[model samples]
Target: MTTFDDREKAFENMFAHDQEMQFRIQARRNRLLGEWAAAKMGLTPEETDAYAKAVVQADFEEAGDEDVIRKLMGDMTQAGIDIDEAGVRAALDEQQVIARRMFIEAQ
Candidate 1:
């Protein structure tokens, strides 16, 4: 391959790797946020695990974090936890940091 082809392939590989890392980070953050909310809502250990998985799946509903936020807000409200979207957003922000740390440690 030409030098240009090699450069292009390298860039593509890097982009793919970055995309995967971002996905992992987001998924980790979602799980962490779910666990936090579950505790707040008094979910049992078994329920917490299922709720965390559901939160991760909720990310697939949209392009950004809106889907996950919406799900959390809805679930919290249904449980009579009296939480707002902004509160959930804050939890998401905190979880993002935890997720990054966990990912780096794993690496």
Candidate 2:
């Protein structure tokens, strides 16, 4: 391949890698967020694990974090926990940071 073609391929590969990493980071964040919400709801250890998985699955329902947030909020409400969107958003941001840090450390 010509140098230009080689460079283009490298950039495409880099973009793909970045997208995969972002997906992983978001998934980790979702799991962490699920764990946090589970604790707030006083879920049992076994239930917590399942709930965390459910939260991660919720993300597949839509394109962005809203689906996961909605699931958490609805579940929390049913559990008689008082929390708002802002609280959930804050937790999401916090967990994302933790997720990114964990990924970096792993590398």
Candidate 3:
């Protein structure tokens, strides 16, 4: 292939890799947040794993963080956890940072 074609392929591969990494990071972050909330709510190990998986899936419901936040807030309130929206958001942000670090370090 020509140099231009090789460069185009390289760019496409980079874009695809970046997109996959973002998805992995977001899912990991969501699972981390879910585990934190689960521990706060006193769930057992099995329950926590299930809840964490649910949280990861919850992220796919929409384009942004709102879906995860809404699910977490509702679940926490129902379980009598004394967490607010701000707290959930803060945890989400923190998990995102941790996730990014974890992903980068793994690379």
Candidate 4:
């Protein structure tokens, strides 16, 4: 193949890898966020695990983070937690950093 074709393939591969990593990081962040919320709600260990998985699944309902945020906000509110959207959003941001670091260390 020509040099241009090789470069194009390299870029495509990089894009795919980046997309996959972003998905992974976001999933991890969601799990962490769920665990955080679960603790706040005083869930049992088993319940926390299930709730974390549910939070990860919540991401699939929409294109952005709003779905997961809404699920968390609703669940927390129902459980009588006094947290607000800003707090959840802040936790989401913090968990994202931790998730990214975890992935990098795993590599």
Q: Which candidate number has the best TM-score? A: 4
Judging by lDDT, tell me the better candidate of 1 and 3: 3
Q: Which ten residues in a row have the lowest lDDT in candidate 4?
A: 1-10
How well does candidate 1 match the true structure in TM-score terms?
Answer: 0.97
Supply candidate 3's per-residue lDDT for 83: 85
Q: What is the C-alpha RMSD of each candidate to the true structure, in Å?
A: 0.9, 0.8, 1.2, 0.8
List the candidate numbers ranked by TM-score, top first: 4, 2, 1, 3
Clashing pairs in 4: none
Candidate 3 whole-model C-alpha lDDT, 0 to 1: 0.97
- Give the per-residue lDDT digits (tens) of candidate 3, residues 1-107: 69999999999999999999999999999999999999999999999999999999999999999999999999999999888999999999999999999999999
TM-score-wise, the better of 1 and 3 is: 1
Q: Provide the lowest-lDDT 10-residue window in model 2.
A: 62-71
Which run of 10 residues does model 1 get worst, by summed lDDT?
Answer: 82-91
What would the per-residue lDDT of candidate 2 be over residues 1-107, giving only the tens digit for each residue?
A: 69999999999999999999999999999999999999999999999999999999999998998999999999999999999999999999999999999999999
Tell me the lDDT of candidate 1: 0.96
TM-score of each model, paired residue for residue: 0.97, 0.97, 0.94, 0.97
Per residue, candidate 1 scores C-alpha lDDT tens digits across 1-107 of 69999999999999999999999999999999999999999999999999999999999998999999999999999999998888999999999999999999999
What is the C-alpha local distance difference test score of candidate 4? 0.97
